[model samples]
Target chain A: MGDYFVLAISSIFINNILLAQYLGNCPFLGTSKKMETAVGMGMAVIFVLVMAGIITWITNTFFLVKFDLEYLRTVVFILVIASLVQFVEMFLKKSIPALYAGLGIFLPLITTNCAVMGVCLILVNEEYNFMQALVASFCYAVGFALALILFAGVRERILLARVPTPLQDTSIALVTAGILSLTFFAFKGMV
Target chain B: MAKSLTQEFVKGLWDEVPPFRLVLGLCPTLAVTKAVENGIGMGVATTFVLVFSNILISSMRNVIPSKVRIASFIVIIATFVTIAELLMQAYTYPLFKKLGIFIPLIVVNCIILGRAEAFASKRGVFRSFLDGLGIGIGFTLSLVALAAVRELLGTGSLTFWVKPIQILGPSFKPFSFMVEAPGAFVALGLMLCIMNLAGRK
Candidate 1:
């Protein structure tokens, strides 16, 4: 129980998926311009990541390892994620139209989000059992969301600042992210 | 059409250079570029996968149904990525360990899939190959440049292969921060700003 708590905390703060691990950066920079979109994307990522983590872990443990097809994990995991995203998209579109509309294009884009795939890969590489993988994946998604929301808030503030022309859009955003990452660094060694 | 092939190839070098202009594959661009060797190793591995996958996807573009094209493209890209991972592990053991998960993460690098979806699927096999080569080289160049700055400033020296050559004076104190996560963003951000400023002229 304590191990899970530590794992969750470490994943969320110290080993943040976006800031430290550098996964899911495309959306981190892209969808983070607006707080609403950031929250929506965050929810979507959390959903997909946790689900993908569990499914991939089950398949990896039961099917791949059993069959000695471990080398095919990358291909298999990606295909699973792609299909899972598609399934989630359809299910949301039908069951929760508001969320489906809110997420919009970003939903489909989640298929390529490295964070989801990264979590699955990390679960396998770290050799986590089922429960640990579940907790870690959820926490990683939370960490990604935490960073995105905070960065979006920072970017929102930066929009008002008189920035230079060359560093206007992504350049400045990246610098802000750098600063944010540095701030996150303060949380290091806490675990 | 023949002339356009050269145009497609040339554009990725500067006009559509990745992680800077396209901003597609920032994950690996930021993650593995702390050192020059890792940057080159990653860039070359990605290039190998991109070039081959582009060709393979281009050739199969006709047979693959449009509905399932993305899945097919991913499978093809994943195969090449696996090949790159295995090859790197065999020959470049140390660099392989340095890279770790980012190598396999190349499958989701976005540049590869972006090229497949944007350029490869619509073009002929030969043209797709050129597009991949151009973008791959461009990405490699940008990554190496980023890695060079980080290594020099962060460590006060640049390492090639296993040997470390001191570039800065012995009295120089390395910034250290320039090689960490935040430094990657700041360095790439500043570089982008410079590139933008230069391109305006």
Candidate 2:
């Protein structure tokens, strides 16, 4: 239990998927303009990430290893992720129109997002067993969502906050991300 | 024809600018920028794959129908990535060891796919080749910059030509953090911010 908590917290802050690890910076800086959109995109990412993790784990263990086809891992994993995103897109569009609207285009974009692929690769690197891989994937997704939402919340405030014209957009956001990343480093000793 | 090819080449250098402006190919950019040597290795490997894949995809663009272009592109990109992986393993074995999974992770880099779909699919073969070369070099330059900063600060020394040319000062003591993950974030974020500032005024 303690170990699990350590992994979870460390993953959230110290090994943060966005700020620290830089796995998901595209959306971290891209879709973070609005709080609502960021949260929606975060949720969409969490969904894909968790699923990608599980599916990739299965494929790696069962197919890649068994068939001695490790070279095919990238192609197979990406195809799984792309198809899964498509399915999720359709499902979300049908069942939860409002949520889908919030996520919308970002859902499709998740197919190419490095964060999802990074998690899968990390899991493979860590050599996590099936259960641990799933847990790690979930933890990674939650961490990703947490970082995105936090950055979005801060960016939302920054947008309204009076700041210099030159540092308004990307500059300010980057500095904020840098500070956030440094803040996350405090969690290192905890783990 | 020559002019159009030149446009594709120049566009990737400035307009597309994979890492800074477009934000594609984040994994390798953030992963291997710890050492200048690692950065160059990753950059060259990626360039070879990108250039070749772009050339092949553009040449065969018409052969592949629109509906399956994405899949075809992936296959083509994956093939070159495999070739890159094998070559790296064969010659630059140590750098390959350092890069580890990232060498394979290059397959999922969105920059490759984005180019295949956005530029390669529409452009002619010669133009696509040039696009790949320009974008690849641009990417390599960006990684070099990122790695230079990270290596200088993180380790306080920079080493080029990994083997057959060992060079580290007696006072060298690595900061260690610069080579770690967080340093990647700091280096890339600062680089991007600086680039944005420069482009502004």
Candidate 3:
């Protein structure tokens, strides 16, 4: 229980997927212009990340490791993520049209989001058991969501305060994200 | 024909240069560029995957159905990425470990996939190869520049393969922050701002 708690806290705060680990940054910068879009993308990422994590773990253990086809992990994992994103897109479009509309193009974009692939690779590298892999995956996604939402709030505020010409748009957002990442360092010793 | 091929190659240098002008593949650009070696390693690995995948995809563009083209492109990209990963592990163990997950994460690097869909699928095989090489080299140069600034400021030194060259004397105190995660963003952000300013004039 303590170990799981530590894992959760560390992954969410110290090893933040967006701020520290540098995964899932394309969406972090792109979708963060609006708070609503950020939240929607975050939720979609969490859902897919957790599901892909578990599925990849099962495949890694049963198929890749069994056959000593570790080299195939990258190819296989990406195929899984691509197909999984497609499935989620179709399912959401049918079952929850409103949410699908909210997510819009970002849902399809999640197929290439590095955070999802990064989590799968990290869990495999750490050699986590099934339970630990699930927990770590969940924590990483939570961290991604936490950072994305927080950055979205910052960006929304920055929309009004930008005084410079060259430093507007992505330039300002990158600098703001840098400062946010700096703040995340304060949690380094927590775990 | 030769002129157009050169055009495809030269365009990626500045006009469509990624992670800066194009803003694609920022993840690896920010993550592995702390050291110049890692930057080059990641860049070359990406170039290998990009060039080959682009060529292969261009050649196969006719056979793949349009509806599932994205999926097919991904599978092809992932295969090349796996090859790059395995080759790196076999030849460059230290750099491979330093790059770590970012290497495999190249499968998701927007530049590779973006090129395949936007350029490779529509162009001929030779043109796609040039596009990939140009973009890959541009990415490498950008990474090296970023890594150089970060290393010099963060550690007061720079290194390629051998011993670190001391850029600052013992009296100089490294900023340290320039080498960390925040520094990567701040540095790249400032660089982009400068690039923006320069581009206007």
TM-score per candidate for chain A alone: 0.97, 0.92, 0.96
Per-residue lDDT tens digits for candidate 2, residues A16-67, read 7876676777678888999888888888888789898999899999989999
Candidate 3's displacement at residue A61, Å, is: 0.9
Clashing pairs in 2: none
Calculate the i-RMS of every candidate, to one decimal place: 0.6, 2.5, 0.6
Worst 10 residues of 1 chain A by lDDT: A99-108
TM-score of each: 0.97, 0.89, 0.97
lDDT of 3: 0.91
**Per-residue lDDT over A1-191 for candidate 3, one digit per residue giving the tens place of the 0 to 100 score:** 99999988998999999999999999999999999989999988888899999999999999999999988999899998888888888998999998888775787889899999999989999999998999999999999999999999999899889448988899989999999999998888676
Those runs of model 1 whose alpha carbons end farther than 4 Å from true positions after fitting are B1-4
How big is the positional error of residue B111 in model 1, measured in Å on the Cα after superposition? 0.8
Alpha carbon deviation, residue B96, candidate 3 (Å): 0.6
CAPRI-wise, candidate 2 is: acceptable
What does candidate 3's lDDT look like per residue over B1-201, in tens digits?
A: 346778899988888888899988999999987888888898899999999999999999999999999999999998888888889899989888889999889999999999999989998899899999999999999999999999999999887864688889999999989999999999999999988998988
lDDT winner = 1
User: What lDDT is reached at residue A82 by model 2?
Assistant: 81
**All candidates: CA RMSD (Å):** 1.3, 2.9, 1.5
Query: In model 1 chain B, which range of ten residues has the least summed lDDT?
Result: B1-10
lDDT (C-alpha) at residue B2 in model 1: 55
